[model samples]
Target: MGFISNVTGTLSDSISSELKDQHLETFRTDSLGQDILVKRAVRQNSFGRNQGSSEIISAGSKVIIPAGTYALMIDNGKIVDSVTEPGIYTWENSSSGSILSGGVKSVMGDVFDRFRFAGEVTKSQRIYFVNGLEIMNQTSNESLHLPYPDPVYGTLYFKFKIMFSFRIVDPVRFFKKTGKATTVYDYMGSPALPKQPFTEVQDHMEEALNLCGSRDKVPFPQLLSNKSKLKDAVNETISEVWYEQRGMVVESIAMTGLTLDEASRKRVEQFDSAKIFADDPAALQALVALGLTKAMNSAASNPAGAMTGFAGLGMAGTVAGNIQNGVSAFGGQSVTGPETCPFCGTPLPLQKPLEYCPACNADIRSYFQGMS
Candidate 1:
């Protein structure tokens, strides 16, 4: 104790006996409230003015530190004490400034002693509560050009959209980079900066893609088909680089869209055309025969002597339609054959062969459609 006699003499000389106009210092952070983060009022004197805010701390004042919030006590813009634990604390002049100190109960005698004490307050006293929840979210408005191999096109450029979320994990680092040490701020605090740092995230994601070397294995023509794998690979890369030292955690990353460039789009269209021909090579070879069949079907539609030129074509087209529709089962039984599973010897799940059977992991495509 720094001479109780001198402390008492100083208090008696400075304060008045009358308690009518006496102001007690008290400060509770908005972060210590029900919301994830809260806003405090400006100083009483500066209520309507843009001058500044005042932090009040008085003896016996109750400090409530809530959950999911990190509270700090700043003396003239410098952090002096912090309270990470949620609890109620009453100030006593003689006790240490830090909230978790054990000496508070032993030193504080009563309201009179508490009133006589003036410990937590300094030349400039303020309390700040920072939300620990994940609030930072970023989305790529423009698609990133993702380069990948194309089996047919060699190299393809695909645009990708990304969404990511982050949380503040370190209070000290956050305070340093945020606004003025004295001002209160939130997720979108800075006017010049975005709510989240998307540009940095994009760079990290690109680096990850380069490291994974997915370009070597997949081609641009087949890029859209491999979307799931691409999303996973990029997400994994972001997780590793989202540093905790920045006092933030990257919570989630999602790939929302993938689109091809004009050249690649045209190439894909051509590939689809080639695929159609390859799938039905016989039809392409038999185009003249098909035209004749179509002419026969048109003549059959009218069934009149006026359609004399298309009479043969109409007949051939009708026969062709019947042959195309005839391959499947007419009633319960197939005119072609039953689509039985080759493996478990059960009927196929659907009329046509699917990738696999639900009941017994059998490849239904093994059974030919036209075999009796």
Candidate 2:
């Protein structure tokens, strides 16, 4: 058979074939390196060739690590060869030795020694194309439930929809922990990748989610109001986790939506409705009094709206009297003296003028202060 047909057709697909020197030099992925997602949680790549994708690096394949690509050779589940820099490289049966000891210079062959590996090219070696791109594209959407604190409502559970980008800073560590690599040979024909690396990636995001109640602590009410700063905090907090784990460097993250649970949603609705009244009862009362005054003034000018307002007030007063009478008639007997709360008309406890009404949680002491 001619050398062209032997190298081009037969050698490309067959792992068992012995590689010639020319084939070794030119062998590489058709495209650049790839982003291989780690979803298995098992934290490792499979042994030899994924047939699913378009690219699969067969055994005895020569590979050149293209620019922006980091390639590795895994033999029997061990990383035996790797090319980090952009260059042409042949995957030898053994490493040249560590650069620190100067063993690499001797192992790197002159132009002539490339003809043989020992005597012939080693058998059954695979090449993995790793994207040296600074940030890894997210393989899937990430959602998490995180605890967020609020000054008024305490801690609220929030549903965070997060998307992040990262890069492989330490390929060896990533491989050691994740055990994931892709070649052009497998079923997929590209790199055999894990299903959802972002899932494990979320393990590092807890501190950012919990907020530790500091470092841009976002209240439930302000979740949307203060999104930009909150995302920054999430990035800062999650970045800390990646740095410690040496898993991957977090390039950037975006929180698309931060939502509240059912209970928190209700609480926020109540807060929106009753904010002025809850924050300052006295002010609420003053506003009512002012409305009544306007109604009385309108009675002289145009008696219709005023008559309606006065009639409403009369019914309200009658309802209030009935409620007070009922409380007095059926409620518990006074535990303390006549320091009754103006709001609940409940007897006060030993907390004195500043005490709160147990029945209604009214600030009896503040009421008394106002009276004085």
Error of 1 at 25 (Å): 7.2
* Minimal lDDT window, size 10, model 2: 15-24
| Residue lDDT tens for model 2, 219-327 | 6556565646655565566554454454466566655567779988888777765876556545455656676667556654664576786676665544444344434
Local accuracy of candidate 1 as per-residue lDDT tens digits, 1-372? 678877776555333221211233344544532233323322233233222214434334456766677665655567666666777655444222322333334323322343455422223455566666655335635667876555465556678876655566666665555523332234433333434445567666665555334443655434446555555555455554344334555665665677778998888788777776556645444654676656656666754663674655555555444333432223223443354445543445354556664336665554544342
* Native-referenced Cα lDDT, model 2: 0.50
* TM agreement with the true structure for every prediction: 0.45, 0.45
Look at candidate 2 and tell me the lDDT of residue 282: 55
lDDT of each: 0.50, 0.50
- Candidate 2: segments with Cα more than 4 A from true spot: 1-67, 73-127, 134-146, 178-180, 183-196, 201-207, 212-216, 221-246, 255-258, 269-372
Kindly report which residue stretches of model 1 are placed more than 4 angstroms away from their true locations once superposed: 1-62, 75-122, 140-143, 148-155, 179-196, 211-245, 263-372
